[model samples]
Target: MSEATDYSRETENLDNCDVEAAYARWAPIYDLTFTAVFRPGRRALTAAANKADGPILDVGVGTGLELPMFEPHTEVYGVDLSEHMLRRAAQRVERERLSHVVGLYKMDASRMAFPDAAFACVCAPFVLTVVPEPEAMLDELARVVRPGGEIILVNHVSRKDDPLAALDTWLDRHVAPKLGWRPQFPWSIIGDWIDQRSDMELMERRLLAPFGLFTMSRIRRLPLSQDVDAPVMPAELEYA
Candidate 1:
């Protein structure tokens, strides 16, 4: 058998060019275009986060579609690459009276502003594909989450055994990246990342409804003999 291809480099990398700008453009109509289709995944991830104690971080929180899904007691902070999208999220918070939403910050996921192990969990909904460097963002996710806490994600992952493997591959190279997301994203981009990490472990992987088009993964952060200092709120970072 031949060596397996690393599909992270299999595509043109076109989508990585202007993710923030692309999402800024999408902000105006993002909810209208995706709210219905993405609702189930939002519910699934938020419900799981709700069960855990302590604070939660919502990365790539576009237009804050999932903000209201959290239980009122769940203290949630949000971050996004798109200021345009985050503006809409602020409006949604006030309009919907989502008080559990602790704060919303305009920042890069790859280089977050929070302290190490600052959260109980981190949830990235349909986000891994949009960033220029997914591995860097994963590093930040692992950094901010407390040991034994979870890093949850929902993404469109492509598999070799998929019935549409041929079409997915064609689109990934020719079309998907241009659309600002790697719809035909290879599982190794994620699976291999998990395998190489000693601090993280795949706790759960499941397919979302309306067909197995989206995958939701939950990764647990293993406690080390030398854990980070206790999570603390940066005085300047936390909003009143």
Candidate 2:
């Protein structure tokens, strides 16, 4: 088969394999294996959540990975694309006896089903890199969050002139084969894209460690008709 055909076939296979199904296979070992490496990045999200003013909605909340951060709150809602992941999150909620403070649902990130301005805060960690249409997911997130509320995103992306993009390209072509999905970094384009959107304001950007790596950004809804360009608060940087 041609290289393009091979890559296409591989990505299709990965897409066909349900993410929940794959996570189900990963859940039993999730905390010990995967979650451990992600603590630093998650910590940045916790800090953002603590600062947000309204109700929090965690999109793609696999196994409630970011749930603990919403402590002392009245309630937090979590949505995931996978039923199995939701099941896992439900179990965590019950284990923590947070039934009154936590709610879980199964939903897609690309096309959020919530009404406009339904949530006070929305978060999608590592979501942009995984979803097929990252911009669509962002649009949906912006749609659901209340005016002046915050959107906290933790994601991975290519470093300009870093040469790592080639590795990601290789993974998209090779490693993702049989897995059914392509590798993507939504953050690379996010900064420039958010700059153009009048509906949102870029509040902060943090550059994480190990070669200008990983990043977390907080974006808030801008007042209607406010100039997208204006002096704003200085962003913070976090090194992993």
Candidate 3:
């Protein structure tokens, strides 16, 4: 292991080294395993992004499975913690001629390099609980998204009375430390933050398909007064 990869045992929840090692393993087979499974959530995110104006940022854009889903006219910038995964995304961009994919950067979700309010919209799919501090990461998402724009997130919000709590506990103890994510993440992490902030508001919270295990949240940044961005169409609306 490299010096960076050798630091896995240093942090409890911030198993960033673990994350690095985990994705390095997953990068090769990630799309093969997760693409079909995660496509619906990506569709929901990109479809909303397509409706809005200006540029979009996809954080934790692993392998950029959602890259080609964007409209040709839609400008997109992607960032991920894993260079191993990004290589695949770069290849996909080249292979498919994704001219609208402006850039793919290796960056931390908690501390990005972009200027404040730099993007019209920022979307993070399956990323919140993966990082060491999800709230700080959420704050970063809020910081970069423009006042009238939005931040969209897709994640698994553990139920208060979760029947799978035991399974989640086992995963956190064994699997998540290796994977560098919190599988039984709570809704309060996102909700309480929104309640405290005057500038951010949760516009929508919708459960996803395939057993309703996933959730999508659309949050708008307040601007005193501005037209809200177009909302993401629901799965029902999509099929109807």
Enumerate clash totals for all models, in the order shown: 0, 6, 0
Summarize candidate 2's per-residue lDDT along 55-106 as a digit string, tens digits. Answer: 7888877777667766665357777766666777777777776653456765
Clashing pairs in 3: none
Using TM-score, give the best candidate's number: 3
Steric clash pairs (candidate 1): none
For model 2, the run of ten residues with the poorest summed lDDT: 1-10
| Candidate 3 lDDT score relative to the true structure | 0.83
lDDT values of the candidates?
0.82, 0.68, 0.83
Q: Per-prediction TM-score, please?
A: 0.84, 0.79, 0.86
Q: What overall lDDT, based on C-alpha atoms, would model 2 receive against the true structure? A: 0.68
Write down the TM-score for model 3. Answer: 0.86
* Runs of candidate 3 exceeding 4 Å displacement: 1-14, 160-163, 224-240
**117-174, model 1: which lDDT tens digit per residue?**
8999999999998787888889989999998899999987876667777887777688
Model 2, TM vs. native: 0.79
Candidate 2 wrongly placed segments (more than 4 Å): 1-18, 161-166, 177-188, 209-212, 225-240
* 77-109 per-residue lDDT for model 3 (tens digits): 888888788888888888899899888887788
Instruction: Provide C-alpha RMSD values for all models, in order.
Output: 10.9, 10.9, 9.6
TM-score (C-alpha, index-matched) for candidate 1: 0.84
